[model samples]
Structure formats: C-alpha cells, structure tokens
Target: MENKKEKKQSKGRRKIEINKISKKSSLNVTFSKRRQGLFNKAGEFCVLSGAEMAIITISPGGKTFTFGHPSADAILNRHLTGNSTSGESSTNLVKGFWWDEQSIESLDLEELNQYVESMEVLRKLVALKVDEMEKGSDQSPSDFLAMDSNSLLDAFASSEAENIE
Candidate 1:
C-alpha cells in the first residue's frame, strides 16, 4: 500500500499536469506532510550550523508558508537599512578596523558603518575615563598624589589652574 502511494506521488510529480490533481482526497495531506518535512530540515540546519535562513513556499493553490532566523523580514531590513548593534557586531568590522588600519581591502559599507559606530563608542568611553581621573584628583588631591606624588601633584595643580582660569 505504501509503495503504491509512493509510486503515485512520483507519477504525479513527474507529470505535473493541471488536469490530474493527485486525487484531492490524499493530495492535500501529502502536500502538508512534505511541507512540514522541509520546514523541519531547515530548522535542523539552522540549529546545528548557526546559519540564518529564510524560506518562503507557495502551495499549489497559492497559499504561502514562510519560515526562518528569528524573523526573516527583520534581518533583511537591518541589512538593507544599515543598522548595527554593539552586541551583534559583525566580525568583519572588528577585523577590518582594529586589526589593520592600513589594509586596502574593501569592506561592505554596512560593516564599515558599524565599525565606525563602535569606534565612536570606544572614543567616548576613553574620554569619559580621562574626565573621571581628573575629577578624582579634584575630589582628593592627597589620594591622587599617593600613587606618584610629584607627577600627580604637578598634574593636579595644572588641572586646577586650568579650571580656575
């Protein structure tokens, strides 16, 4: 019985005739089962390989089934709009900018944009740290001088003079 069904399915797929719909009684069921199998295979690949995939299928009657990577449209929109998050920073960005600033190799514009944004964030953090150090000296000169008296005192004094002026 199973072999007979398989044979019929093979025949139907090969002939692909508009006139011969695979006995409406079983055709819908077969289509549904096959579609599920395809979806399951896609899910397995995504889980094992960490791949982002989007699948869109249209049934013979024109119904559509779409699946993939958290949300297919969201990923596609991000790629098109050039939005970069710090958490999901692209590897290319890190390699291109920080690894070798002199390299002539071209990077994707979106990835380069992300790199520039990250660099700006780092620059802001460093500036903040410098400001905090200056404020620490202002808050406690003796404490600031404990580490290196002469140099700290000189810097603190200069910093204070600059503030006053």
Candidate 2:
C-alpha cells in the first residue's frame, strides 16, 4: 500500500507592489476595498475620540461616496459655517478647513456667493472688535475668553446699541 499526503493550499495575504495597477477590473476591486477600509478607520476614530467626522470620496467612475457620523451635508455645513455642535476647540475648528481648493472651485456660483457673504460678515465682525479695542473698551481679553457664543453675540449687540445711542 502506498501512502499519499495531500498538501493544503495556504490562503494568506501577499505583498503587492505599490505601483499603479494597470488592469481596470483589478483597480476597481482595489479601490472598492481600500475605500471601505478608509471609511472604517474614520468611523473608528469618531467612536474612540468622541469626535465627529465626514468623508467624501469620488470614485474613478465619478460616483460619490460619503460617510459621516451624522450626515455629510450637516457636517459640511457646520464646518463651513464654523459652528461647533460638539464644543470642539479652535484647533479643531481650523482643522475643519481641510477641504481642498478644487472642491471649493467646484461649488456653484450661488454657493460661492454665499461663502463670500459669510466671510464678509465675519470680517466686519472682526473689524468691529478691533475698533472696540482701539477705543479702549472695558471688556478685557479674559472677558472675551470666558464668553460663549450667545454671550459673544450679546457683547456685539450691546456694542451696536451703544454706537446707536
């Protein structure tokens, strides 16, 4: 009697070259897999750090893919308006400006106009604050530091009232 042993096939991960994949089908498959992995990592980060995140990706075929802790549109609007629903610090607010210039260029004319208007309003508010400082207002830097959004708005409103009076 002859004994024959069957060898099992190993199904383990293999290292692949970092070069661009030439085959369309292979490239599509890789993109699909890697995109899911990237989204998963974003979700894990949100869960672990109690932070909110939104990801937007365009596939090679021009299809849009998005993942957000809340919703993509909501997260985007909040970032654009510089409103912090999560009480994040100013550093995180700066980080929200991570959108590429190409994305901004792709916005429609109406949206672009709105962005410009919002920036103008912000600029005017900053100028008002600077004027107040130059006029030697009683409100100190520490007072501004302790002010929340509503209080800051109130401060501005009171300043406007004083100017009117």
Maximum-lDDT candidate: 2
Clashing pairs for model 2 are none
Looking at model 1, which ten-residue stretch has the lowest summed lDDT?
A: 139-148
Return the top candidate by TM-score. 2
Query: Given candidate 2, what's the lDDT at residue 37?
Result: 97
lDDT of 1 at 93: 34
TM-score of 2: 0.41
Full-model lDDT for every candidate: 0.59, 0.70
Off-target runs (Cα >4 Å) in candidate 2 are: 1-17, 87-165
State the displacement of the C-alpha of residue 32, model 1, in Å, after optimal TM-score superposition. Answer: 0.6
lDDT against true structure, model 2: 0.70
- State the lDDT of candidate 2 residue by residue for 34-137, as single tens digits: 98899899989988987777887776766667777654656787899988765444345455654443477788998887667555655777787778878999
